[model samples]
Target: MVLSAKTKQSGVTSTTNMDKPNNSKRPLSHATDSTRTSESCDVLVLSNKMMTNLTSEFLTEQTTQPDVISKVLLERNKLKDLPFELVDFINLEVINLSYNCFHQFPSVICEMLSLREIIMVGCEIEALPSNFDQLSGLETIILDLNHLRKIGDTLCTLNKLTTLSLGMNYFSVFYSTLPDQITKLNLDNNHLAVFPDCILALANLRQLNLSFNRIKELPVEIDGLTELEELLIVKNRLHALPSTICNLV
Candidate 1:
């Protein structure tokens, strides 16, 4: 559901299995481009496109229906930055910017207040933008395979965040910044060498993954996750399981 504009430089269309974005030059409802105006787009798949950026020509028309787009998928591109013009999509909720070479978190996303999910896997982002927690509607964030080592207290402020994935990063020590609101967490393939004591405080965490790390033991305090339905700790250096492991049902 992205603009099927001829990229001024690459001559690419930047879309996968959806309708072309509406513009003054195109019909309101083409046979394929059915998402227009009141028929808000639910998903926009722009993955695997070689696009480096979304230019003004592609963004010039989204303002005509600021509430039309709900999701934008921009994975597997060579993008390093995003156009600020994206702020016009007032109703946008989900965004996937995976497999790009982004060195920094795109700050423009912090302004999209309606966002509920953000997926930015395999990027180079080492830090989140300031005031990131202000997007109070966010529920899920996947930042796997990035350069992140620490995220401040910003994440815990989003009360709606329930799912968090932070695998394959540069983390050596776990950060206690995790919120109790999280029900699912993934920290596989990092450099962690200890069972992070902070996780024992998450009374609401239902599933935890700590596979492929250097951890040598699980603590008896892990029974604090009384609600845990699934726990994975394969491929670690543990000599034995904690005695309280049987407490989790």
Candidate 2:
């Protein structure tokens, strides 16, 4: 697989080329786009060696317009200008913009129609779009080490989400509802004291970590999670874990 960047006056567009493996002549179906009229490459796949050298060069040349690319991994880049306008391209499935300097909420992110996993950890984001719940297809959201104060009510609409991490954030608000689809949860090193009983609604959760928080007691209904496999509350101010917790394991 080879990465090629095409630059226009607006920015850069990337194309991934695959050298034919001698044995297999089958065509690879990168994502399809209905509105794209001209010849275009919608997906790019690169090996570890190619990704290490060209990821930054590919992104730096982007044209600041809607991209046809479906998946972008730009972690640990010195990225300052996150093209919010590019979010209108709903074809993106996975984006890794971690370790950048993005501040405040990025509203355009909510418009990505196919985005499934977003890893924007340590971006310094303080809030999210108000209609953030509209991202119905999102499955994994990693916002660890940001400056978020509260999770918007729209969070309950991400029914496909399986893993969530808000560790090291400044979450001051209380959560009254959590999506039932969540299977892995991490709230380590936050400022939460207690959450509403509605937390027990996640009956399918398998791993839950609330270590390093200021929580004092467990909500009695928490034992209702019969599928829970690991529950870690190592550094919280718990007097005693509910006997129900022992029953789950």
Candidate 3:
């Protein structure tokens, strides 16, 4: 009942607007993507640089030394696709490409095996690549505000995933099974009329957000989520209550 609850992704990789990268900067060309922080630290912030496409050449040109970076923040860019040369980042882990104009998941990201987190909010992406399962090391995925409807079990393979944010999209139905290890689930502002049955199976779930939907009621079997801690249910069409909700305590 904190009213501040925000929904995360359901069965796919998603991000949130709140978790957006720092995109506060004057519009610059892709050539000047490097920032003062990247020159000194392992975290590279290439946000608000007006980049339509990120290239390995620019990565190399960012500094005289082109080696493994830990985190790369490329928020509020116009990136649609990444170069294949991106695979050279063997040790790269976290990448933030939020608030872009991509209509599809950048396939080059699939090869980064060491990656753990991928945050890309406010994009036009509709589908994930076929090789998305290759990233077994992924632990978090934030992909809010896009055209995602069905996940096709792409995220189910990410056994390491714990947090997924996919709110503010076109999800009227979600049949894909999410990872049982997932601790937080967000499905706000979608077209869901009936509560997703798949969610009831997550015994380890701690936080759940089903706000801003068309759901009318909850099932009495809701008590199955014994580990749930925070539940957000705002702006729904519910007229009745499920007695099992009391068991969440």
TM, every model: 0.81, 0.71, 0.83
Supply the TM-score for candidate 2: 0.71
Q: Supply the global lDDT for candidate 3.
A: 0.72
- 187: Cα error in model 1, Å: 0.4
lDDT of 3 at 169: 74
For model 1, residues 1-249, the per-residue Cα lDDT tens digits are 121222223434343234432431212111122112233355556678898887766765433555677878778899898888778778998888888878999888999999988888888889887689889998888888899887767787788988888888888888657678888788877889998877888889876777677887788887788887666665667666666766664
The collision pairs in model 3 are 8-166, 8-186, 9-165, 9-166, 14-142, 14-143, 15-142, 15-143, 15-144
Ranking of predictions according to lDDT: 1, 3, 2
Clashes of each: 0, 4, 9
Q: Every model's Cα RMSD, please?
A: 14.7, 16.1, 8.4
lDDT of 2 by residue, 1-249 (tens): 221222222243322344422312111111123212333465432212223233334544653433567766555655545555455555788766666666865566777778887777787988877788888898888888899887757688788998887778897545646789898787767887885455588889876766567777787777688877556555556665556544554
Candidates arranged by TM-score, highest first? 3, 1, 2
Error of 3 at 168 (Å): 0.5
Best of the candidates, TM-score: 3
